[model samples]
Target: MSALDAKKIAEAEALMGQVDSAPDEYAKAGMYFKAATAYRLAKSSDKSKDCFLKAIDCYENNKSWFHAAKSYEQIILLAKENGTLSEVEEYANRACSLYQQHGSPEAAAAALDKAAKMTESKHPELALEFYKRALAVVLIGDATHQASEFASKVSRILVKLKRYEEASKALKKEISLNLQTKSYGQVGRLVVALVLVQLAYGDLADAKKTFKKWGNRCEHQEVSTLQKLLQAFDDGDQELAAKVLASPFIRHMDVEYALLSKNISMPQCIQNGI
Candidate 1:
């Protein structure tokens, strides 16, 4: 180890000794916290994390909710940097719950949001739960932007999971929020997305009704392309559907197109005669 690292390790050892000899829970927690800082400086991340956890336990024993929450936050950051995803989620959830208990709804929501993003790719169901928790907290705090963004994310994940009904509900909330904010352009796009979800769910009649209700609000090019794509699906013309999907205007609806593709048969034109 470098000289500086050695010095820090020595300082950590001194603090650890002090922790063992501390007269009260508060004193012990402080020493452990200081030792954790020294271990971080010594480039011993595992040791630092352990010390931080010890400090958190001591703080909790003393009923210092805020301090315990802060320690959990620190452990979460450390776990994230180490790419220990399970630990990151565990500590983040703990910290968020503690923050909520402390009446810091914004901090609680932010923590859950971070955990949701971190777990979205590998653990989508868990991420969905976290996003829902975050949305609940954000709604209580009047954070429109976070609420809308998180709801959109939840809808996307639900779509991926083929939970179309839940996805539709989430998208409806997002669209309503967009309307409330007078974000007419985004609301138009979201309405188109809602129709796509309905189609994917095999609610063809409802999809048609939604398109008739909101199609004109979207850009003409987008509306025209989506209509042709929908018609190709309805006609069971996979070749035409593929062609429409290949067009740039409709390519951004990749997820919706994928769902549609699964339900349609190959075009007769592309098949050899029996």
Candidate 2:
């Protein structure tokens, strides 16, 4: 280990000694937690986990939630008694959920973030499970901003799951939440995403409708540009298409053009219409 790591281990051992002899339960718990932190810094998570568990025991025995939260957070890191991968995964998830029930939205969000990352690489199903779990806690918790943030994340996970319909629905829900919260920037972003998802599902008519709805709600340059472009495309008017191609609407046409470009063949109707 590096000198810094060795020093942290030494400090943790010292704190553990103090925790062993402290008369006050709160003080003992705090010391144990400190020891765990130091051990964690030293890259000794296995050894550090014991100190955290001890801190949890101490805090719970004293009914000190403030410290209990800190200890539970560390216990989640340890995850299991013997630390099997799946066992630890379940333990962390359950413990984090319990923390959320106790009115800790931030804690729950943090744990869910970790869970999402863990499941993303090795098991997407597991990632989605954690994403849903996090979504449940965020919706129930009092952290509106955090909840909205997690909602955005859940939308991404659903997309990864190839549940395109569900992803579109989730995106729409997030847009509504942002509207209700008066988070104009978030609403703008989600509206764009919603449009893209709709377009992805070949629901051009619905996408057009939603684009119009959002255009009326927003005065953003980007939104205006998108509305014009979508209207132009829907109209199949050469003049409107020419206008869009020459205007800011070009950027807004990217998603549509990207998809359609790949499979584009001149429509017989367009030839007939002209």
Q: Which lDDT tens digits does candidate 1 get at residues 41-121?
A: 787999999999999999988887777888888787777677787777688789888888888888888888878887788
Candidate 1: lDDT of 261? 36
The model with the greatest TM-score is 1
List runs of model 1 lying over 4 Å from the truth.
20-28, 41-46, 61-64, 253-274
- Relative to the unseen true structure, what is the C-alpha lDDT of residue 48 in candidate 1, on a scale of 0 to 100? 96
Which regions of candidate 2 are displaced past 4 Å?
A: 1-25, 75-95, 114-135, 185-189, 212-215, 218-274
CA lDDT, candidate 1, residue 3: 96
Error of 2 at 269 (Å): 13
Instruction: Give candidate 1's root-mean-square deviation (CA, Å).
Output: 4.3
In candidate 1, residue 96 scores what lDDT? 84
- Per-residue lDDT tens digits for candidate 2, residues 1-274, read 8999999999998887776589888889889888888988787878787888788778778866545665665665565333444644664565575565566776766776775675566566777677677777777765566667767777876665556678788877777777777788667656666665665565667877777777566547657666765665565654654554455433444343333323323234533554
Local lDDT at 217 for model 1: 66
* Error of model 2, residue 169, in angstroms: 1.2
